[model samples]
Target chain A: MDKVILAKDVSLSYDSNQTIIKQATFSIESGSFVFVTGASGSGKSTLLKSLYGAIKPKQGSLIVGGVELNNVSKSKLNFLRRHLGIVFQDYKLIKEWTIEKNITMPLLINGYEKEVTLNQAESLLKHVRLKHQAGKYPMELSGGEQQRVAMARALSHNPILILADEPTGNLDEYSSQLIWNLLEGANTQLKTTVIVVTHHIPSTLNVDYKHYHIEYGEISEIN
Target chain B: MKSIKNHLSLIVALISILFSIQVFIVVERSIDAYKENLAKNYSVVVVSEKRIANSEFLSIDGLINRVEELSPDNIINRLNTGMDQKNINLLKLTLPKFYKLYLTKFPTPKEITTLRKNLFSNPSISKIEDFSNNHDITYKLLVLFKGVILVFAIVVSIVTMLLILKELRIWQFKHSERMSIMGLFGAPTWLRSAVLFRLSIVDAIISSILIYLIFMYISTNRFVLQQFDNINIKVVIFDTLNDFFLLLGVSLVLSILLATMIVLGHKEEV
Candidate 1:
C-alpha cells in the first residue's frame, strides 16, 4: 500500500515557547484504519491538526496527500485541504443551515453542480440514516444525529483522507458504535485513509487495524 | 427584526448622505436663479461727456449688457413752467449726459470692483453710481449662505461614510463564524462573503428608495414652491431620471466599497 501521511522528526506546538509533539516519526498506509490513543494533553489532537494544515509542524517535514504542509502557502494549503475531510469533536455543523445543506458544503466548495450536489447530499443523508431529518436544522437534531450528519459531510466529497478528532468522545454507546462502523467502512470499502484520535478504542472492532499510543510526548506504534 | 437592527446604522448613514447631496444641489440651483432674477432689475447710473450707445457700453470689457439714455424731458418740463422753452432747451444741452448701464447678472463684490475700474477707465465717463453699500451686504450674505450649506454637506457625507464603515464591520464580525466554517471547507473568499454582500446591496436599495420618496415630497411641497415664487425665480426642484440614477449609483458603489473593505480586513486577519 502507498503511504498517505508521512511525518519525519515532526515537532508540533501552538507557540514557539512550548513544544507538544517532539521529533515524532510515523507513516500511515493508504486505505488503513489507524487509531491514535493518548492520555489527556498528550498532543494527539495537535498531531491531527498538523495533517490538515491547521497547525504547522515545528522543525519537521509533514506531508499529506502528496503536499508538504510545513511552511506551505495559504492557497496551496487550502487546495490540500479540499482533498481532505475532517470531523470535529463537536460536530461543527453550521447552525443556520439544514442537515442536507451541511452535507452539501464540501461538495459546494468543490464547485460541484447544484443538482448533482443535492442528489449526493440526499444519498449521503440516507446512508447516515438521517434522511428524515434532512430539512431540519443542526440544533433541532439530537447529538448522535448531528454527529452522523458530520460524518456524512466528511465523506461527501470522497476525499483521499479523513481526520477525525474524538468523533465519539461525547456520544452514547449506540452513536459511538455507528461512528466506528462508518469510519471502518470508509477505510475498507471506500479505500480512504482514516486517522482517528481518541482516549480509548473499542475492543469490539473486528477488523485488521493499527494502533499508535502517545505517551511522554512520543508516539510508538503498537500491535 | 434582528436583520433590521443590524442595518439600522447603515440606513441612517445612507439617508443622511443622500439628503445632504440633494439639498446641496437644490440650494445651488436656487441661488443661481435668484442671482439671475436680481440682475434683470439692477443697473448702474453713469454721467458721460457724450451719449453712450448700447453697442459702446457692450464693447468696453463687456462689463454691462445694454445702455439706455435717460430722458431729461420730465425735469425739463417741470423747469419750463418757471422759465422759457429756450432757456430749458439750453439747460438740457448743458446738462451732462445721463445714461443707465444694465449688467448681465448680479456681480460679486470683486466683480463689481472690476466693473467700476473698467467703467472709470473710459475717458468719456465722469461719474458712476453702483449702490455699493447695498450690493456689498447682499453679496456677502449670499456667499455666507452658500458656504454654510457646502460645509454642512461635506460634514454629513464624511460622518455618514464612517458610520457605514463601522456598521459593515459589525456585520462582518457577526458572520465571521459561518464564514470561517465555510473557509475551512475550502470555500473561496467571495463565496464565504456572499451573505454580507447581499445584506449591503439590499440595504442600499432600500435607503435609496426611502431618500427618493423624501426628496420627491419636499420637491412638490407648498412651502418650498412658495419660497421660489416669492423670489420670482423659476428653478427646477428635481430631475427624476438624473437624480434617481445618481443616487442609486452612489448608494450601490458606497455599499460595495465598504463591504469590500470589511472583507479584505477579514482576509488579512485570517
Candidate 2:
C-alpha cells in the first residue's frame, strides 16, 4: 500500500515546559478512511495542522505526501497542501466571495481560466446541492451552508487526501448527515483518503475507517 | 491575463486625470494673478523738478515727468471717446505756469514689490530706503501656498493608492473561493490580486476626472488677481503642474508595483 503519511516520534509544543503532542508516532496509509477522536484539547487540531503543514513538528521527523515536515519550504508546503483538503471547524470561507467562486478558489489560485473554473465550481456545487447559492456571499448563507460550500471548494480540485476538523460540530442533524454522506462519497467512490477529527463518535460508523484515540499526548490505534 | 490587462488600464486612467486637474489649477490661478497685478498698479506719477524756481516749477516744461502720459496705449483706448496725445495736450494747455506736484500718498511702499519685479530702480525717487513690511508678506504667502498644495496632492495620491491596494487584496482573497485552488492548480498568488487592484486604479482615474471638472468650473471666475500682484502665480502654477505630472507618473508606477506585490504576497494556506 502507498504510504500517504508517516510520523515517527513527532513532538510538538508551543512552549518549553508544556508539550502538546510529545514523542507521538503514527502512520496513515493512502486511500484509507480514518477518524481521529480525543477530548477537547487532545491536540487533534494540531495533528491535522501538521499534516497540512500548518504547524511544524518541534522535534523528530514526519512526512505527508512523501514531503518531510522538517525544514519544508513554503512553496513546497503549498505544493503538498494542494493535494490535501482541510476543512476547518469554522468553515474558513471568505466573507466577500460568492459561494460558487469560493468553491473554485483553489483552481483560480492555480491559474485556471474562468470558464473551466466556473464549470468545476458548478459541478462541485451541484454535488453539494448548492448550485443555486453560487452567487450568494458567505455571510448570507447559514452555518451549515457555509460548511458545505467550503467542502465543495476543498474537493473541487479532486485532492487525494481530505482533512476535516469537526465538519459537523455546529450543524443540525439534517446538515450533519449531509456532510458525513459527502465525505463518505469522496472516500469510497474516488478512493480518496479521509481523516476526520471530531469529539463525538457517530454510533453507526457508516464508512469502513480505522479509529485512533489521542490520550496523554500519544496516539494509538483503537480499532 | 485579462485581469492583468484590466488593471493596467485602470492605473493609467487615474494618473492621467490627476495630472490634468493639477495642470488646470495652475493655469487658472496664474491668469487671475496677472489681471489683478495690472489693474491695481496702473498709475501715472507727476513730479516737480528738484532745482526750479517757483515759476519754472509751476510750468509743464519744468515738471520732470508724468508717467500716465507715456504708458503704451492699446486699440481699446484708440476706440474710446478720449483720443491719444489730445488728452495729454488738453491737460497741459490748461495747466498754470506754476507746477503743483500731484503725488499719490505712500507711493513706493504700495507697488514697491512690483517695482522690484520689473527691476525698476530710481522709479520717481522721493525717498529710496524705507519700505513697508507688508510689501514682502504677499510674496511669502503665495510661495508657501503653492508649496503646500503640491505636497498635499502627492501625499493624497500615495495614501489613496495604498488604501485602494488594501481593498483589492481583500477583494481577491474573497474571489478565491476555492481555497484549494491555490495549491491544486499550481497557480501563482499574483494573478487574482492583479485583477482586483487593477479595478481600483480605474476608480482613481475616474475620481481624478471628477476633480478636473471641479477645477474647470472654478477657473472661470476672476478671482483675487489684484490682491496677489507682487507674486507670480504663473511660476507657482507651472511649477506645481510639473510636479503634479511627475507625481502622477510616480503614482502609476508605484500602484503597478503595489499590485504586483499583492499578487505575489497572497496566502497559500487555506
Residue range B146-254, candidate 1, lDDT tens digits: 9999999999889887887777778677777678777777777888889779988898899889988988898899999999998899877777889878888888888
Tens-place lDDT per residue, model 2, B1-270, is 544554544445455546544654664566456444533543333232132353432342221222223222343355457656777555444432222232233233435444333322323323222223543454455456667776766676676656656655664455444333444333444453544465555544454444445444544435633334446443343343554455445555555665566555655553
TM-score of each: 0.89, 0.66
Candidate 2 structure quality by residue, lDDT tens digits, A1-223: 9888899899987667988888877888888999999999998888888788777899989998999987898678778866777788988776656888778777766567999999998888887888888899989999999999888877877888999999999998877877888888899888899999998877655778888988888898996
lDDT of 1: 0.86
Which ten contiguous residues of candidate 1 chain B have the minimum total lDDT?
A: B261-270
For candidate 2, the per-residue lDDT at A80 reads 82
DockQ, each predicted model: 0.50, 0.22
RMSD values for the candidates in order, in angstroms, are 2.9, 10.1
Residue B108, candidate 1: C-alpha displacement in angstroms? 1.7
Docking class of 1: medium
